[model samples]
Every structure is written in structure tokens, then in C-alpha cells.
Target: MIFQHSLYHIRWAEDKQILELVWKPTTQDLVAEEFQAALHNFAGFGATYGVSSMLQDMRDFMDYLPPELLRWRDIVVSPRYRQFGLQKMAFLYPPEMAPKNMGNAPIQIRGYAEEFFDVYESATDWLLTDIRPRKAG
Candidate 1:
């Protein structure tokens, strides 16, 4: 593990060029600033390491970020991934918590390709593969 915090744990798979993030369930009051700062720190680490792909394990995360934070992530944090040369990102969610439209649908965030999976194996498989959805004209 390269980085560890109360909110999340980050591990790098050097051979696979994949950065894995496992979010921990929050036990105290959640703070947005802290979360943002943690994300920035991780982004810096990823940039330094030239991370190309990411696997986010969100099954243990229980807190709901506010809409503003979500917007901030979309507007601010995501571009940093692109700047760092990130190509693919996979999110693993619990089967019941998986988004309704997540089935076999390709999601593009900022300029990188993203996909959602309910199983860790599936998520890792997708991340290790080179298949990316072509943008629609």
C-alpha cells in the first residue's frame, strides 16, 4: 500500500499499472474538506507514479457525499486524472448498491473511460483489459 488514511487505502499494482483504492466505512462525522484533501494527495501520488488505470472499491464506503462535492469531483478532481495520463477507471460497488444503468454500459468521465462492476474480479478483469468504448459521433 502506498497511502493509507481513515477514509481510504491506496495500493499500487506495479505489474498491472493499476492503482487500487479501497474506501473505508466512516465512523465519525464526515468532512468534505478532508475528503477533498485526501483525494488531492492521492492524485499527486498517482501523478508521480504515472498511474494509467484505477480500481475504486466502494463497497465498504457508507457515507453519502453532498451534491456540491459530487460536482466538485466531476469538475475538479476528474480532470486531474486526465492530466496524469489516466486511461481507464473501474468502480466496484455492492450488488444491491450498483447503479440501475450500470449493466454493460460504458461510462465516460471527463476524457477517461469508466465502468461499474458489482464484483471485484469483474472490475479487475475490466481494468486489466484494453477494451475501451468508442465515443459516439
Candidate 2:
């Protein structure tokens, strides 16, 4: 996906039903509509009838300043969360981003995804499926 915000991990899973896209929240940015549009385009490939995403681990993206660090770009992280939710599946960062505690973050995010989506072999599995024949009048 062409997201303005950086995505932590992205891949296919669960025999292709799950197109997991995990994000580690950083107050550094906001997600835009073009992001979803890009993923929507890529998902058009092949017989993979349906594609969904899993977004998780957003904390920095939601932090408001103490009247100190606040900026215009920081207006509504909460709404940004909703925008990203337009994706098939979206997971939250679950909490804040303590720079000191980032060491174990990846494991935490991946664990959440796997716990929900199960497992998949590869992106290839996401590509090949039975194509539906369009009805001809």
C-alpha cells in the first residue's frame, strides 16, 4: 500500500484470506486516502476473490502534545485511525510508544496478528484462486 505513514510489516497470510499490514504508530505522520487506493489497486490482481488487512500497534500516532509539542499536523490522530480502518483489517498499537520499550514491540504486534489471522504460506497463495466468470446477457 502507498501509505504516507510507514507500515511496520506487510505480507499475505492464512492461505491468502489475510493480507496483513501492521503499523507501529509514530506521531511523525497521518495516513491519507491515496494509501488505501494503492492497496485497492494491487488487490485487483488474479482470483484472490477477497483481500483484507491487519493493522496494529499505533500509539505515537495518537499522542497529543502537552501544549508543547502539538502542531497543526497533529490535529486528529484518532480520526486517522478510522481512515486506516478503511482497510480490510486494522489493528491498533495497543498502547503508547515508549522509546525505552521498543525492543519487544515487533514481537507484540506479530503475536497479535498471528493470534487473529492464523498462518499462510506465501503471497503466491494470494494470487491464484478460481476466477468468477462474468455473466453475459
lDDT of each: 0.81, 0.33
- After superposing all C-alphas onto the true structure, candidate 1 shows an RMSD in angstroms of 2.0
**lDDT of candidate 1 over 20-111, digit per residue (tens):** 88888871466899778867876787798988888888898787878999889878888899999988888899998997756465667468
Off by over 4 Å in 1: 134-137
Off by over 4 Å in 2: 1-9, 14-17, 24-27, 31-34, 38-90, 96-137
Q: Count the backbone clashes (under 3 Å) in each candidate.
A: 0, 5
Largest lDDT belongs to which candidate? 1
Q: How accurate is candidate 1 locally (lDDT)?
A: 0.81
- Candidates in order, TM-scores: namely 0.89, 0.29
